[model samples]
Target: MTRSLLDPSAVPAELRPYLAELVQRVGILCGPHLLSVFAVGSIALGDYRHGRSDIDVNVVVEPSLPGEVVRELAESLADGALRCPAAGLELVVYDSAFVGRPSDQAGYLLDLNTGPLLPERVSFDPAAAPAFWYVLDRSIAYQSERVLYGRPVRHVLAAPSQRHLLAALMASVREHTTGIGHLPDNQVLNGCRSVAFCRTGRWAAKREAAQIISESEPDFRPLLETAVRSFERPRTAALELPATEVRTFLAWVRERVEEAAESRL
Candidate 1:
């Protein structure tokens, strides 16, 4: 099976060295608690865009870690020494017991959303961590995790059922679409990708997912095209898609996602 760390050759050429540096630094920081580390999200999905993608990693440690140690690890990740390879490094360190089974409380020791110069205050308490959305992260990890150390991903992670995954995606879509005004292009495309996953078992990158949706629903082609281009060239300034159309499309997608989720239920 696919049980090894991601091949550097598979990553963007510029990102290889930095990816290697991450593995080494994480291994050092976690020490005995570190059971395994794996790459997830777009990096593992083979749809990583150089300028836009954040390297998402899951660190599996012992059942529990001392609060102090967790703090240190968080600081290390935010430190300039371990600069992120792309937009930023998005990471979550999960207690092994938490991953082995579900819990009422957060399962992570540390979680952060940080990039080169914009480091958010890292949190050690799982409950306080902003990125503790387990269902979504676990689903993504189950689908595309690549081992950086320890046992293979299949051995470490329990695959989430399609029903569970769809439900989580629908919940996210409902939350994001509920607000008024134009949803960001990334969020818009993410809703499309989640719908795509519900229809097809495969996990598609944002651009690929938008393409599939546009083909399946021609009316949204122009919007999806705009979103895809924005994702590809984050630096380029572009005209925004009309807010009315964006809201309409999101509402339509929200209904379809809810329908799909209900069927599974």
Candidate 2:
């Protein structure tokens, strides 16, 4: 078991204290059963915006916990859900069995945002969901730059293979863009980042990917710039992009991802 806490200064100004207290409370709640806890997504990436982005966290715990205990924990977590300064919070609890064993399927005990105990429950299939997505997250954890608590990320997560990383990228893009016509800034930026990862094995934030696309694929600069702007400054007023253009761009990104997958094979 490993435990190294991060300085509160790493998180956004408005969210640091809240996250610190939340992590502390959760740690205390789990106590002896707690294995590790850390963050991911925009917040971990340091690009999270107050009103636009979400805080993503993963808590690993002892596998012996009863389902009822998990439910109780979920309910407790909900009491502070709205306290998140970002758009919302997304937190999942996984068993400690995955510490070193890497697999394409990860079994999670609970997802706070879409669990049975939450009011905003959504459909989720843990079995069919590809675990390859954890590859990027594992990579982030190994870096130790974003870990919030528990064992050092490298000790807790297995290093993901290139094939797994690319597979996860494709899967995420398909899930987010399929049948979706209008693209938001995050979607657009994520699509570009997927393309960048597929071409070069290097993973990057959306902003970095936008810069890469601007330098390499100048034709897409206008769209990428617009996406960056939208992501940086989210408007409270209902804002929608041209559906036709979004659809076309999404199709192009999908095609690129497919081509990248094929090239790998």
Candidate 3:
């Protein structure tokens, strides 16, 4: 069986030491041959937002690690969860032996190491953006960008359902999120959640602006911010209008898309 130890590069920088220890123990306990580790969630994607409850990690092991070893490690790490108050900890361990079983049946990535684990498959989209979105209010204390064990994780840069997805994400926010769908949005609200979503969408817009400006034209941060706010303005308006104006909603979406198309030009 493949006992390739966890690749440290695949892990994130913030959880380096703990993962490193995990690697050491894994190697010590499981002999070595065909096992590997991978980072699979927000922390790896580089867009982890603030106020995340806990960091999620996927530890890929080979079929070689004994079931007992996997069980033992899981119990130990579960105890580690108590150390951090803000974020809960979970590890879904996987390798070749455990892939065929039900997907839901497998516990956290770390736990899979116990017996017949399978390598979790990951796929990435080329055009998707991983702009930083606020999880709670800019308090991502545990998820760091630095790569600790394996390759970086990612989110799709482009969306096939950009509008629909945006629509769904903002659905519950109509009443809850003040500035989001409000056209000609309140600049104050546009800048930050203020008392609303706290540091959510605006933070994403801010990060998106920074990245775009830095890459396309470092001086364009402000311009980019304005552009994002422009999108938010129209979107916010369309999202809130009366249901009788279904046609108007579609028209607005067409306008939003057209506007997006033009801005790229």
Candidate 4:
């Protein structure tokens, strides 16, 4: 099997030590069963904010990895244990077999969340996780091609299909519009990113996507700018945007995604 490790020189200096320790701990825990370790989200997208972003990671392991090892790995790297330097560490462990397969549903061996912005959760069941978010995340990770360790990302992870991505984008829009979860800044930026992804079959950072929209649709520039500013600043408390306007923006995103999907047909 192909193997590679991230070049510390390639990442921000502040993250160097944390990532080094993470690789070391994971290597010790998973041993030969470890297939790969990669970063996704803001880190991969080159928009990592020192205090705002989560250190999103995807760890792939051989199908034979022991359940005990999985639990131990989670417990070891959890925020307090590994000492997450960012807002948190959102890590998902995927069986190598699952990475090789294509499916509409999301599946993972472990979903560990640790950070100050959110509560801690160490989840093992896919049924308990948000499948749409996983679908979108997998698509983004595959596209980002940021591999911190092991074989190349393309060699290990199959890209989620456009249909699945669009479906996930639609679901995300619906979820945000309902205002059941997610912060206002997240809701706004996510909507902008979804719209941009639908228009161009490429993933862009949240801030980048907002810029794309502002240039193309000047009418929404003010709102998009506000969201981008909010995203850059450190969070102190829950923030809110105009609900009606946020919903309206998401509706436009849903419409655009539908249009893009239809064009492919």
- Candidate lDDT (C-alpha), each: 0.71, 0.67, 0.36, 0.83
> What are the runs in model 2 whose C-alpha is more than 4 Å off?
1-5, 79-82, 114-119, 122-125, 128-136, 143-145, 179-183, 235-239
TM-score of each prediction? 0.87, 0.84, 0.37, 0.94
The parts of candidate 1 lying over 4 Å away from their true place are 1-6, 102-106, 117-119, 129-132, 178-183, 235-239
Summarize candidate 1's per-residue lDDT along 1-265 as a digit string, tens digits.
2233456675677777776766666667666667777777887777788767777888888875666777777777774657776777878888777777643344576787687634565766766732325667776677776676676766666766666667667767866675542336766788788779878977787888898899999998888888777777643343466677778888988888888877877
- Which sequence of candidate numbers ranks them by TM-score, best first? 4, 1, 2, 3
TM-score, predicted candidate 4 vs. hidden true structure: 0.94
The 10-residue segment of model 1 with minimum total lDDT is 1-10
Query: Residue 70 of candidate 4: its Cα lDDT?
Result: 92
Compute the lDDT for candidate 3.
0.36
Considering lDDT, where higher is better, how would the candidates rank from best to worst? 4, 1, 2, 3
Candidate number that wins on TM-score, 3 or 4: 4
lDDT of 2 by residue, 84-141 (tens): 5555666777777765666555556776663222245321345644565555666555
Q: Considering TM-score, which of the candidate structures 2 and 4 is the better prediction for this target?
A: 4
CA deviation > 4 Å runs, candidate 4: 1-5, 237-240
TM-score of 2: 0.84
What's the true lDDT of residue 227 in model 1? 77
| Model 3 per-residue lDDT tens digits across residues 1-265 | 2223245454445555655665555555555632444443345445333233235545545666666776565555543432322134434555644432322122222432121112222212212312122112111211232323333312101111333323332332332233333332222222222212121322233334334333544443343354344444423232233323323323333444344434433
List the lowest-lDDT window of 10 residues for candidate 2. Answer: 114-123
